[model samples]
Target chain A: MLKIENVTVKSEDKVILENFHLEIQPGEIHALMGQNGAGKSTIAKVLLRDSHYDVQGMISFHNKDLLAMNTTDVAREGMFLVMQNPIEIAGVSNAELLRTALNDRGKNTGNILEFHRELTEYCKRLELPTSFVHRDVNFNMSGGEKKKNELLHLWMLKPNFLILDEIDSGLDVDSLKLVARSLVEYYEAYHPSILVITHQKTLLDILKPQFVHVLKDKHIIKSGDFSLAEQIFQDGFGASTMRNGETNE
Target chain B: MNRIIVEQEEVFLQDESVFFTEIPNSLVLHVKGNVCLALTSIHHMEVYLEKGSHFLLEAFVFMKNQTSKIVFHNEDDVVLDFHLSCLYEGENTLEVNSLVDKERVRNYIRVRSVERFGSLLIKATGEILENTRDAFYLEDIQSLTTHQERVKIIPNLLVSSNEAICNHNATITHVREEELFYLRGLGIEEEKATQLIKDGFLKSILQIEEIKK
Candidate 1:
C-alpha cells in the first residue's frame, strides 16, 4: 500500500504537480489516465525520489516515509517503476542486472544456475527469447522489446508495488497482449499493487483496472470505476469539469 | 627493464603460422619475405614487415609501463590487424606508433585499443606514406576512467597518400550517469554497479565466439 498526501512537485521555477494526491491499497490495480504533460509520470518520478524535482508533502509506503528514502533504498523497499522510456545501457547484460537485483533483494541465494533456469522460463512466458538474457539491457532493443524487458524485470524482482509509466505506448498488438497477460499473471500470482499510467483504452481493457483516476490540472480531478475511463475515451478529460474529490469544478 | 631484438628475413611461405607467446620487457622484431603470420603476446614489440605479407597481432595485456613502435612496408599486398586491451592503474604512460609504407601495393591496417584506469596517457599515432595507392587505415581508441585520476588519450592519423582511406576516433568517458542510474534503480548498490559496468566494458571488446573446451 502506498499513500501520497497533498504532494506538490516543482522543477526550477515551474510547477509540475500541485496538490497531487494518490492512494493505492494492497492487491488493488489503479490506473492513472491523463493527457500529455498532466503530471502522471511525475508522480512516479517523485515517488522514486528522482532528485531532479523539488517535492513537498508526505509520501509513505506502509506507514514509512517513502519521500525521505533514496531511489535505491525505495527500490530495496519493494518498489519498482517501469520507466516510460527504458534507458539503453551498453555493456550490462540483462542476466547480470537481474542477478544483481535478485541477490541484492536476498531473493536469489547465489544459485546462479537456478536463477538462469528460472529466468529462461520467465522469458518464455513473456514470449522473449533466452538470448535476450545475455544481451545488453535494452541496447538496440525495439520499443516493444524494451517493454517486454521491463516485464521481465517485474518477473525477476517481484516487488510489492509496481508503477508502470505509459507502458502501453509503443507496444504492437501481440506485445500488448503479452504485456497485459504478464501483468495479470503477476498480479494474480504475487498480489502486488500496481499503478498504471496511460492514455490508452486498449491497455485498460486488458488489465481491467479496478479504479481509474483522471489526472488533470496537476491533480487527480476525477475518480471512478472503469466506466469513467470508457466515458473519458468517449467524451474526454475536459468533459469531467470536476475538481479533486468535489462535485463542482 | 630489459630489451630484446628479434630479426627474421629471407623466408618465403604461403601458409599462415601463428606464434602465441608472452614476452617480458621490450622486443624489436624485423620480419620479411612472403608469409602470413599471426602473433599473440603481452609485451612491447616493434615489428617490421616487408615484401608481400599479412600479419595479425593480438595483445591482451595489463599495462605497467609498456611502449611499442611498429612499421610495415609492402611492395605487393600486405595486411595488418592489431587488437589490444589494456588496464592502467596508478601513474603510467603507454605510447604506441605505427607507420605504413605503400609502394604500388594494397595495404590494410586496423588498430583497436580499449584502455581503462586513471592517471594514464595513451598516445597512439598512425601514418600512411605518400604515393601509396589503395591503402586503408583505421584507429579506434576508447578510455574508461574512474575517480579524479586523469586520462589523456591522443589518437592521430596522418595520411599523405591521395588514395588512402584513414579514420581515427578516440573517446574518453567516465561511467555514464544514466547507465549508473539504470543499474541502481534495479537495487544494485553503487560500488557493485560500477564494477559490473567496468566488467561489461572490458568484456564487450573480446570478439571471441568459441571456447576451446
Candidate 2:
C-alpha cells in the first residue's frame, strides 16, 4: 500500500504536480489515465525518488516515509519502476546483471546453478529465447524485445510495488499482449500492487484494473470502477467531468 | 658487479644456457661477427645485442633494475622474440633495431613465427612497475622479403605512458549512461553500476593465460 498527500513537485522552475493525492491499496491495480503533460510520469519519477525535481509533500509506502529513502533503499523496500525507454548496457549480460541485482537485495545466496535453472525456466514461460539470458541487457534489441526485457526484470525481482510508466507505448500488438498477460499472471500469483500509467485502454483490457483514475491539470479529476475507463474510451474525459468547478479551461 | 663482454662474429647458443647470468649492475656485450645469443637477465643491467653477421637472437629480460637495452644490427635469417618485464622501482628502456641489406640477395627471417618465407620481427614487452619508464621499439628496412610482416603489440600500463609511443591507446571509459539510468530505475545505486562495468572490463583482460599467471 502506498499513499501520496498534497505532493507538490517542481522541475527546472516549472510546476509538474501540485497538491496531488492518491492512495493505492494492496493487491490492487490502479490505472492512471491522463493526456500528455498531465504529470503522470512525474508521479512515477517522484515515487522512484528521482532527484531531478524539487518535491514538497509526504509519500509513504506501507506506512514508512518514502521521501527520505534513496533509490536503492526504495528498491530494497520492494519498489520497482519499469521505464518508458529501457536502457541498453553494451557488455553487461542480462544474467550477470540480474544476479547482481538479486544479490544486492539479499535474495541470492550464491547458488549460481540454481539461479540459472530458475532464470531459464522463467524465460521459457515468458516466450523468450534462452540465448537472451546471455545477451547484454536491451542492447541491439528491437522495440518489442526491449519491452519483454522489462517484463523479464519484473519476473526476476518480484518487487512488492510495480510502477509501469507508458510501458506499452512503442510495443506492437503481440508484444503488448505478452506484456499485459505477464502482468496479469504476476498479479494473480504474487498479488503485488501496480500503478499503470497509460493513455491507451487496450492494455487495461488485459489486466482489468480494479480502479481507474483520470488525471488532469496535475490532479485526479475522477475515480471510478473499471466501467469508468470504458466510458472515457467510448466518450472522452469531457464526458465524465465532475460538477466541481476545479476543471481547468 | 662483474661484467661479461661478447665480441663480434661469435655465436653463443647452447641448450639451457644463461648469458648475463647473476650479473648485478652492468653488462657490456660487444658484437662484431655473425652471432646468435640466447640470453636471459635476472638482474637489472645494460645489454647490447649488436649484429654484424647472420644471427639468431632470443632474449627474455625478467625483473630488471635501472635500465635495459637490446640493440642489434644487419643480419640474415634472424629470429628474435624479446620478452622484457620490470618489477623494480627504477626506470627501464628497450631499444631494438633490425638492419637488413635490402639490395643484396633476399634473405628470409621470422621473429615470432615458424615456416614463413619473408622476414619476421617480433617484440614482446611486459612491465609491472610502481614508478618507472618501459619502452619497446621495432625498426626495419623496406623491400627485403616477398611476404607480408605482421606486428602484434600488447601493452598494459597501470599508471601512465608519458612521451612513449605515439600510437599509445588508453581505454578507460565509464559505464554507459543509459545503463546507469536503467539500473537506478531498478533500485540499484549509481556506484554499484559503475563497479559492475569496471569488473567486467578487467575480467575480459584477465582471460588471457599469459597475463593471468
Candidate 3:
C-alpha cells in the first residue's frame, strides 16, 4: 500500500540517492540489502521527511501524498521506522511517551487501568521487566534491551507500515529469536507491510520476506525472492549484485 | 530530619535532613553527621562546613537578569555533594566557589544542564589549599541552549596541594535534532517533543540514574 517513484535525495549539497524507487502492496514483506553508504537507510529517513535531505519525488501511502506531509503526519498515517540506534531520553518514561502518542492519535487512553494492563502484558510477552514501563526511554539499557524497548513501542503503537532498519544488529542469539517471534506474532495479528533493511540472514530466515531488493549506487539494482537474501549472505553483496545485472523494473 | 530557620550564626546540625526553600541573608553551617539540604532558590550566600562533617545539597535555580555568588568552606574530613540545576530566561550570572583547606576533604560540584533563553554566565571554582593531604575535588558544568554563544561556562580549578586530586569539565549544546526526529516519528508533534525533551533534561537533575551514552 506504498508507492515511491523517481525519488532523488540530497544532503548538504551531496547527492545521496538518485531516482530511487520501490513499492509494496498490502501485507507484503520486502527485504532491502545494501553495503555501507548505499543509501538504504536514507530511503527510510527520506520517507519520514527528516528535512535534512533535499528530496524530489512523489511518494503515496494509501493514495495519500506522503512527501507533502510532515514527519508526524507520516507517522500518524501508520508509518513507523525502528531506527538503527534508539536514542536515550533522560527522564521521559516509556509509559508517558506511549500514552501521549496514543492520545494524540485519537486512541482511547482514558481507561488508565486498561492501558496499564496492556502495557504489562506486552512487557511480559516481550520478556522485559515490568519496571521498564516507568523507566526512562532507553536511558541506560543494554543493546539488546534497547532493541526490545523499541519493540515494546512497536506493539503499543501498532503501526501498519514498519521500516525495520537493522533491527537485528547488536542482538544476542536469544534476543534475536525473541524479536523475530514477536515480529511474527505482530505480523500474523495485523498483517502489516514491512520493509526490512538488514544484512544478516537469521531474521530473514524467520520472517521469510516475499521480496528481496538489493540497493547499490544510490538506487535499487536487483529484486528477487528470499533466495536472493540467502545468496547474498552465502556469498556477499559484491557477488550477489553482480549476478543480477538488470535494474529493478 | 528537621526544618529550622537559619539564624545569623553557626548552626551545628547533627543527623539532620533539611529542605531550604530559600537561602537566608547569611549563615554558617556545621554538619556533625550526614546532612541533606534541598534548596529551591539561592542568593548571595556563604556556607562553611566545620571539621568532620558530611553534606549533600540539591539546588534548583530559575533566574532572569539576576546575579548570585555562593561560597563554601570545607574543613578536615568534610565531604560535600553539591548539585545545581539552572534555567535562565533573560540574563543571569552565577558563581560558585568551594574551598577545601583541610586534610581528607572531598568536594563534588555538578552544574546540571543550564537551559538558556537569552544569556547566562556560570562559573564554578574549586580551590584546594597547599599541604592538604588527600584532598579531592571535581566540577562539571553543562549547558543546553540554542543560543550557544549566549551561554558561557567557566570551570576554574586552583589546587596548590601536591597530593590533591582536582578535575573540571564543561559542555554546551543545543537540543539534539536526532532526538527530536525519533520522538516525532512516534506521532508526537514537534512542539510537544521539544517540551518533553527539555522537561526530561531538567528533571534528570534529581535522578541518580547512570546514563549509558
Candidate 4:
C-alpha cells in the first residue's frame, strides 16, 4: 500500500535521513524501533510534508506519487499522521475541529446528528468526559489525554494509512490498554495499514505488528518479525542490531 | 434598586437601579448609589458616578459606523467595571476616560471583537490623583480581524500617586500561525480553518445560545 525508495532527507546543513527506503502491503502493521535522535519521527514528518525539512526521491501510495502532494492533499487521500506532541490552540473547540475534519472527508457529511453521536461515543470509550467535546482542542490537557484526543481524531477521520509517532509515551498502563484496544478495533473494522514508532514493549505486544524495522542514523538498518522488537527491548538498540536478519547489519 | 428594561432611543438613569437597554442612543446616567447597566447596540453615552458607589456596564455593539464616548468619575470607595464587545462593518471609534480622586477606588475595562471590512479605534485613559491612596486601574483590549479589517488601540494610564496600581494591554491580529497549523493538520483546508478560528475567536462575544432563544 505504501513504498519509499531512495528518499534522502536533510535539514539545512545536517543530514537527517540518507537514502531511506521501506515498503508496506495492505492491512500490514510495521513497527519502527530506535532510540532518541534516530530519525524515527523525521520519517513521519517527511511523509506528512512538514515544511521544515527537505526531501528527495520517491514515495508512492497506491502507486501514486505521494511526495508531490501537499499536506492537506496527502491527508485527503487517506493518510493520517498522529503527531508526537499535539499542538494546543486556544478558543478552538474539539468538537468544531472534529466536525470540520469529518465534513472535509466528504463521506461523513450525510448525517450531522449521527456524526456527533458517533464522535461522542468514541470519546466515551477513550474515557474522555462529554464536556471535552466543547472544550478547546488540547488546551490544558494532560499528556495521556492529548494522546487519547489524537486517537479520537484517528478514529473519526478513518484514514487508510496511519502513522503513529510515540503514541504510547506518557500513557499510564490503563490508558495504554485502552489505546491498544482502540487500535485493534480500528484494524479489525477498517483493515488499514499501520506504522508505529515506539519504544514500549507493552504497546507492541498489544498491537502485535507483523514486521519490525530498526532505524538508526536516519535509515532502516535491520528488518525482522515481532521478535526483533522483543530483542530490542531486552538487549537495547545497539545490541539488537547485531542479531537482526533480512538486512546487512 | 429597581430592575427596568429600556425600550427607547434615549435613557436617563438618576436613581440606584439595574438598567437593561437594547439598541439605544444618547444615554446620560448618574449613579448616587449602586447600578448595574447592560447596554446593547448603544450609539452614544456619558456616565458619571458619585462617591461610595459601584457601577457595571456591559455594552455590546453590533451596529455599523458608530461613534461613542463615555466618561466616569470615581470618588472615595468607588468601583467601576466596563465590558464591551463589537462586531460590525465600517469605521467605529470608542473613547473612555476614567478619573479616580480619592482612596480605595478601582476601575476595570475589557473589549473584544472579530470583524471583516471593519475599522475600529479605541482610546482608554485612566488618571489617579496624587492625593488618592490604594487606587487601581486595569484595561485589556483585544481584536481579531480578517479580510481587510483595521484596528488601532491606545491605552494610557496616568498615575500621580505612589500607591496606585495601573496596567493596560492591547493585542490586535489575525489568526496566528501555530493556531492555523493545528487546525490544518486535521485535514481542514486553509480557508475553512481560518473561518473556524474566526468563529471561535468571536464565540464568547456572539453568545449564540442567548440569541437563539
Best by DockQ: 3
Q: Number of clashing pairs, model 3?
A: 1
Q: Tell me the tens digit of each residue's lDDT in model 2 across B1-213.
A: 223444433333332233443444444444433444445553222333333233334343442223443443323233333333222222233333333321121222212111112222333232212232232323221111112232122332232434222122312233455556567666676777765654444333323223533
lDDT of each: 0.74, 0.62, 0.86, 0.80
lDDT tens readout by residue for model 2, A1-249: 799999899999899888788999998899998778888988997897777889899989988999998777888788898888887765578898898888788785388888888888878877889898887788789888888888888888899899999999898888888888888889999999999998788898888888988888878878888998898888877876552355555
DockQ of each: 0.55, 0.28, 0.72, 0.46
> Which tens-of-lDDT digit does each residue in B1-213 have in candidate 3?
455555455566677788765456455665666778777776777787878888888778787788888899888898988888888778888999998778999998888755545788999888877868898898988887766789888888888889898999898878898989999999999878877887788777557523411
Candidate 1, CAPRI quality class derived from DockQ: medium
* Local accuracy of candidate 4 as per-residue lDDT tens digits, B1-213: 344556564454544445464444666667766677766666566666778778777777674787877777778888887877777678888888888778898888777877755788889888887888998888888888764347788888888899898989988877776667656666888788877877677774445423642
Give the poorly placed runs of model 4, Cα more than 4 Å off: A108-112, A242-249, B1-10, B14-26, B62-69, B87-94, B115-121, B144-152, B172-174, B202-213
Model 2: what TM-score for its first chain?
Answer: 0.95
Arrange candidates, best DockQ first. 3, 1, 4, 2
User: What's the number of clashes in each of the models?
Assistant: 0, 6, 1, 0
Q: Candidate 1, residue A137: CA error in Å?
A: 2.1
Candidate number with greatest TM-score? 3
TM-score of 4: 0.85
lDDT of 1: 0.74
Score chain B of each candidate by TM-score: 0.74, 0.31, 0.86, 0.79
Better of 1 and 2 by TM-score: 1
